[model samples]
Target: MKRLVLLLTFLCPMGFIALNAQSSSIFIGATGGANLSKFKFTEDLKELYPASNSLLGLNGGVTIGFEVQNFTLHTGLQYIQKGSEYQTDNFEDEQGTGFYSATEKLHYLSIPLLIGYRKYL
Candidate 1:
């Protein structure tokens, strides 16, 4: 995590500098989306739950883009929420219900850098 942060700290400034030096047409944007996530247990853990269900998650981020002629450079930073829930029939408390549920959540920071060329036919 620390390494990821450090790398981004260094790369972001350099990316901005490179974009400014090369392109006069710069564009900034923001993006957001939703995801459905599920967990597939391994063979050893399959006995715990018959199946896992999908959970709704969200992601959003900012984008920086530089364009010159037919070529473009793009980069962005995003935050993602991901996880899933599972119901198990084997686990039981003193009540003897033999049913339980669990949730797992994960948060992530994502950075994407891309370069592309566009052509008109």
Candidate 2:
């Protein structure tokens, strides 16, 4: 069935890579870090949201790399948290509605692929 072929197409490569972890040309590693995020506003808008603070977040991921001669390929899967906590200045809208403060939190999954060439100095 087409489903079976599709499944195998993806799974086969993973199997080969797992089995070949001992190969010198292939490497696997973990990555992790912290992130500080905040928002910036232009001069005009700055007056409307005069106060803000950086939000602290986390990021982590696994990376896989393959090397061939002088060329290399890298890819990874990662989790990231982003957004900020912000407050608005005491400003009234046309209808006189006042706004105060709020925090925004966001979560994301990241997939990145990169290719590189190494030159010996």
Candidate 3:
């Protein structure tokens, strides 16, 4: 299942380029970046978790674009991960308790399609 999706993601662009090869210019590139994810809480919640910090994440993807004259079409597939970590002060209750901590991690699959027109300077 995964392989099929990956194959299609790459092949679909090739198909477009092949069909437009005679009249359009083809562009293929790789993209990557860093992400800092953080969580903000309200006044009441902030008091419970005094120690909050941003988590580091990474993203990377492939890009393909076709240009015909001043008009262009582009698309890409990307994988992104973003999340945050939270920690709370220790609290006492009827039962013995320890400090509380939580980590959230989210994953995303991104597909962007774009059309563009260029202006000559």
Candidate 4:
């Protein structure tokens, strides 16, 4: 589950907007270092236990938007999860064992701004 979320998060942003055959274009994007991280029991427990500020790893997913003249809508699905640390009293205890991971995934309609310079090759 966690890995799935990570995969989605990483992929969804590849081509959120796309043009038509007339346009024919590809998108370019990138991010900082430190792509994904290992699972942390403290963080996982906190995200499930309490509701507070938390830190987490990043996942990716890609969406392909079609071009309809001057503008277009990019619609697709996404699955993402984050590393967290709550350290509160609201979750099962794990002593040197291992905590199950958490993930978020869903199919969605994503609309992005597509100029007249994008299309399929």
Candidate 5:
């Protein structure tokens, strides 16, 4: 749910750019990057628990584009890994009191499309 929203937040601008692009010469390229992410719990959860730590992740993909003069239209597919490390100290429940550590990971397939116009000074 939240993840989906976050994904869309990241992709929507690119989609809007792609839809508005005015270019036609094709070009191909590769893209890769590392991402650091953390879990952002809801207010309800935060009231009762500590925030989680960020985890390092990686993303890689291929990009295709169309260029016309100074303008370009681009699109790509990427593999993304998002994760976080969580720890709780003196966590108490009906069972008992203890410390806990957990790691979470999620994988996503993303497609980003955008248009760019470059100018030289």
Candidate 6:
């Protein structure tokens, strides 16, 4: 728990730095958007696994972005998690009172890159 607190302490501040970097070219603003949730089954199979976006349903959050040259980078704090349900079909009873359910709380940070168009007034 302490390690997680330590890591988040450093990482969240990095977001603050990204907000303050290059005052001339960088502008920070709040953003919200749709996000997909996925789970990690292994480290080497990020591309191979069928990413289940519907596992935890839709998610939304606020983000901060900065413009560097023609590229804009966005980082967000998201409320999201991976979830699942377990069930079995049986000839004895199609509908059974016996079923299992579980939920996990998740917290995450997201980052994205967006190409930018600039206009001066």
The deviation in Å at residue 27 for candidate 4 is: 7.8
* TM-score between candidate 5 and the true structure: 0.71
Better of 1 and 6 by lDDT: 1
Give the best candidate by TM-score: 1
Q: Mark the regions of model 5 whose C-alpha exceeds 4 Å error after superposition.
A: 1-24, 90-97
Per-model TM-score versus the true fold: 0.73, 0.64, 0.64, 0.31, 0.71, 0.36
lDDT of 6 at 57: 48
Tens-digit lDDT string for candidate 6 (1-121): 9999999799868755765774535455554455445454566543343332334444556666666444466666654444533232221334565432334445555655454556655
Candidate 1 residue runs with Cα over 4 Å from true position: 1-23, 94-96
lDDT of 1: 0.88
Total colliding residue pairs, candidate 5: 0
Which is better, 4 or 5, measured by TM-score? 5
Best by lDDT: 1
Worst ten-residue run, lDDT, model 2?
A: 15-24
RMSD value for candidate 4:
13.2
As a TM-score, model 3 comes out at 0.64
lDDT of 5 by residue, 1-121 (tens): 9999999899978755765575456789999999999999898776445858999999999999977677777898989999999877757756676676789999999999797998968
lDDT of candidates 1 onward, in order: 0.88, 0.83, 0.85, 0.46, 0.83, 0.52
Whole-model lDDT for model 4 versus the true structure? 0.46
Cα lDDT tens digits for candidate 2, 1-121:
9999999799868756754664438789999999998877789878888888899999999999987666677899999998888887587767666777789888999999888899988
Model 2's TM-score against the true structure: 0.64
For model 4, the stretches where C-alpha displacement exceeds 4 angstroms are: 1-53, 89-121
> Which scores higher on TM-score, 1 or 6?
1
Q: In every candidate, how many clashes are there?
A: 0, 0, 0, 21, 0, 0
lDDT tens string, model 4, 1-121? 9999999797656535332235643344432222333334576554564543345545445566554444454544444544433334444556733343344322233334433454556
